[model samples]
Target: MTEQVMAAIDGSQFSEGVCDYAAWASRALDAPLTFLHVVDNHPQTAEADLSGNIGLGSREHLLEELAHLDEQRAKVAQEQGRLMLKAASERAVEAGVVEPRTRQRNGTLVETLSELEDETRLVVLGKRGETAHQDSGHLGSNLERVVRSLHRPILMVPATFKRPEKVMIAFDGSKTTRRGVEMLAKSPLFDGIPVHVMIVGAETGDNRSQLDWALTTLHEAGHVAEGEIRAGEVEETLRAYKEQHGIDLVVMGAYGHSRIRHLLVGSTTTAVLRKADMPVLLLR
Candidate 1:
């Protein structure tokens, strides 16, 4: 019944990275690691609906063939998922995780994770899922939903795993973000890693105070932390700071704005997820 670091592996290009990062987090948190692979049920559901509408004769034969085809596809996908889970667990073992576990289920990724959320300490996923386009700017279709649904911290890793040496916090002084800073201050995930906290937009007194508070909080927790204020868009400023400092990971709070509002005006969280080349740890 111990809490575990649950990693979502979908046999995408990011699967390896997900395993690596999840392994790192498991070791850092001293928690058990579990790799989860969910085979989507959309195809089977659609095929079943179509099969019922077929009348008779040739159509009935077609329905039977289609049902058989769907069955075959589902079996193939399940076998593939099993293989992928085995590979992921092996990779985690190689990455210094001890006795990593894996689970394969028939459902959506979001639903599976939600069911296991109580036992999960952290969730790690690739920036893009298997169905996502190859374009670097494309966000995974399920990323936002997963983030919205899970209360636990989610680490969205890039296509490659790089041992993070420097970390950046996109601070905005909101309650959620403050909680994120608190988590970083107390969590051992970034124990020896130096952190740079940056604030975007005007350098007002309140912003400076908040930045100071963040630095103080981190410093109190023994982090080698520093703060800065920049003038520009949040995403751009954070990206620029990351590049300038060679940050391998970016940590921040996300989804503060309503979903509809974010859709209309766009969101810094979405923008960063779309553009970041490094791993991003999101706190909801």
Candidate 2:
């Protein structure tokens, strides 16, 4: 089956940005675009009988009414999802996605994406989804799960969109980041765009060697690439470098460390996503 750039959108402020970035990625990869909307079936009040010490007849009547209300809510949610997908499709067409596709599923977002992961070359999502308060700065409830569950690269974009010009990859000589460099070398998604490889930590021999290896790999691939080893906190250094260089996109490894390590020291991927104002393409 042909691979596609799958974009998961919802009725949120970030939906427009998701469409914009999805369209850009589809064109960059020369692949088809798909807009997916999932009407999540959250646990409903009908499942709980909260009427305590009520008459049997009254309790039954309340339960029936609750069930009816749940059905009505489901119908409204389905309709809303359909309209969202239609708008996203039209937006994609306007943004130059040729004959974009849309799918509305009745399930949880993570489960739906996992089922369609095989056909997805890339996944585009909002930094914070509709379930999260936009001002709360919390990562989308499903973002971490999707990233961990799927094997494809996931692009998590902010509430706004901007065509990426320069991209920076946060490197730390890990096996995952090495594979990321190799993937970037072969992928045309960032072709003709400048790539900067940044290593944040003590500037040591290993770090220099890793940085050199990355640069050489990109150079061999005919990419305009440069690398540097900086000394500072990982997240802070990455943010400063991105700001100073005006990088529009940040590419990095997601949850590459061991579970114990992540538990001991929080995951850099999560930290970056929380504070990032630009798009982040995470390679797992």
Candidate 3:
């Protein structure tokens, strides 16, 4: 009954890296790792001309053939799931996870997550999956809803995994940012990592004051933290800072001052998530 770090994979290009990051978290946090592959029961329809010109017997035969094909496709999908799970599990084990477990469930990804949320310690998912976005620069369709559904901190894995050495949290002096600092402080996942509390906005006195407050809280929690205030647009400034400083991980609250802005895919969070070339730890 140990809490598990749940790694959701879709047998897509990002699945392997997802497992590797999950393995790293499991080892670092001393939690069991579970790789979950959800067999989404998407609807499949048999073609129908509906012209009513065919004989009954021929129509029946065609319907039967269609059903058989559907069954075959389901079997093939299951086989692929098994193979993906096997490969992901092997990768996790090789990455130093003590005993990684694999699960193949049948449902939509969101439904499966709702059922498994109670047992999850941390959730790791790819920023973009195979069909995550049909177009370039779009987040996975399920990403927003998944973040909304879970109360846990989600670590969105990017295209690849490099052992993150430096971690930075986007600070805006909001209540959510304060909560993020507390969450990071309470967890050992970022132990001994130098944390850069960065604020990107109009460099007002209040902004500097908030940054100092964040710095103090992190210090009280025994973290090596520094506060820096920059002036510019939030997304552009933070992205520039991350790249300029060679930041390995980016942490930020999923929502900032306005809930309306983040209600859809039109938020600074999404912009950073889409642009950053590294893992993003999104706190709700």
The candidate with the higher TM-score, 1 or 3, is 1
Model 3: per-residue Cα lDDT at residue 41 = 54
Model 3's TM-score against the true structure? 0.91
**Residue 104 local lDDT, model 2:** 89
List the candidate numbers ranked by TM-score, top first.
Answer: 2, 1, 3
Winning candidate number (TM-score): 2
Q: Quick one: ranking by lDDT, best first?
A: 1, 2, 3
**Alpha-carbon runs more than 4 Å astray in model 1:** 43-56, 256-266
Give the top-scoring candidate (lDDT): 1
Which is better, 2 or 3, measured by TM-score? 2
Backbone clash pairs for candidate 1 read none
RMSD of 1: 2.6
Q: Which digits, one per residue and each the tens of the lDDT, describe model 2 over residues 1-284?
A: 89999999998888999999999999989999999999877832235557666788799887787789878988998999899999999988998889999998998888999999999999999987776766646776678778767888999998788988998999887888899999889888998989999988787888888899999999999999987888977788888899899999998888554445563123777788888889999887
lDDT for 212 in candidate 3 is 82
Would you list the clashing residue pairs of candidate 2? none
What does candidate 3's lDDT look like per residue over 1-284, in tens digits? Answer: 77899999875677877888898899989999998888765732335555356687788877777678768877887888889888888888888888789998887777788898889888999876665554547788667778888877789987578988889999876777789888777678888887899987777888878888888888898998886888878899888888888889988888886646556433888889777678898887
Alpha-carbon lDDT, every model: 0.87, 0.86, 0.81
- Residue 202, candidate 3: Cα error in Å is 2.5
